[model samples]
Target: MPRVGLFIPCYIDQFYPDVGLATLEVLEQHGCEVDYPAAQTCCGQPMANTGCTDAAVPLAERMINVFAPYDYVVAPSGSCVAMVREHYTDLLPLTNKLQEFQAKTFELCEFLTDVLKVDSISGSFPYKVGVHQSCHGLRELRLARSSETVGDDFDKARQLLKSLDGISFAELTRTDECCGFGGTFAVHEEAVSCMMGRDRLADHRAAGTEVLTAGDMSCLMHLNGLNQRHAQPFPVMHIAQILAGRQPEGITPVNSTDGSVA
Candidate 1:
């Protein structure tokens, strides 16, 4: 078992802490000796993405040092993991340790599939789950094959999710479309972001999706917001929560819907 340091992204920490906890649960189930670094904070993806690399430098450095002692640093977010892997070189003077840290930082599904060699998951989530392949995960982490690429297609997240008994996958019209939550892109272009998000929501709803799940909570966060704004929210959960034996049926508002027309 690898000694893993959990990297909970800022959004997950403040807004969706349960996702962070669920990620911890999933990691532990697979025999990871998990430790959450209380010192761990934002990895500065927002700042870096917005061309403020200088502002992101200190935060990126903090993450590197905080998780340096662990054998592996695992995060539930592919976008955040992509930040450490793809963007950190611009933010810091690269040391050998920084290089190694970049290589070893695995998204939760990647850790389960690539690191732990997890093919068969032990759980049951019998619902039509609509898969959202966020940009960072699809392109950066290569968690799933991008639609534009030429190759035998693959989806690491779907592979893990399907391993659960009785899980039915919703056939999305556009499988790998962006959910309009490009970190700072959403903040800068709110109207466009919400429009794109609603499009995603409509696709999922049309597919008769029982629950929507994705490897990256940020994508789900954007879609979930649209679901709410339309006054017909379904249960939107992280893939970690589903894999860890949690169900959307257990939600307080019964899928966060208010008995209104969508």
Candidate 2:
């Protein structure tokens, strides 16, 4: 078993701890010796994305220090993993330590497929699910071939989900479109952000999916907020939760007037 360090994103640790717990359970089920550095915090994605590299530096350094000792570092959110793998080179001074840390960091799906060589999960979900291809996961990590790309194609996320016993994928019109939750982009451009999120939800609704699942919770949160405000009938879930056979609780159904799980 490999020595793995779990990197739970700041928002995931706070707002959606279930996702983090599910991630831990999945990794452990696969025979990994997992460790969580309790001192871990944000990966500085928000600060860096908002053009504040100085503020992001300390966070980046802290991540390197905490995760450096492990053989592999994995995170449930592709956006956060992408920050370390792609942006850390630019954020921190080029050092062998930083390079090693970046090289070992991987998104959860990528780690399961590439590192663990897992073909299937014991989890099952009978509902039709719409997969939101997060920009960082799809574009940065190459978890899936972009619709814009031409040639042989494969999707790590879809491949893993296909292994589940009763899972069915919802047919999305724009499968690779961004969900409009680009960290601080949603806050700085509220109208555009909400419009984009609603448009993404519209695509999912058109597919008649009972649930929406994605690798990034930030995107799901933005999309779910729009879905709730408009009384849409689906819940947004993290792929980790689905793959671990755990459904999120307290999420209101789309048609419910009040935000209460049905």
lDDT (C-alpha, whole model) for all candidates:
0.87, 0.87
For model 2, the stretches where C-alpha displacement exceeds 4 angstroms are: 248-262
Q: Write the per-residue lDDT of candidate 2 for residues 44-142, one digit (tens) a residue.
A: 999999899999999999999988889999999899999999999888889999999999999999999999999888755666678999999999999
Kindly give the stretch of ten consecutive residues in candidate 1 with the minimal lDDT sum: 253-262
Alpha-carbon TM-score of each model against the true structure: 0.93, 0.93
C-alpha displacement of 6 in model 2, angstroms?
Answer: 0.8
Q: Residue-wise lDDT of candidate 1 within 7-32, one digit each (tens)?
A: 99888888999888998998888898
- lDDT at 141, model 1: 94
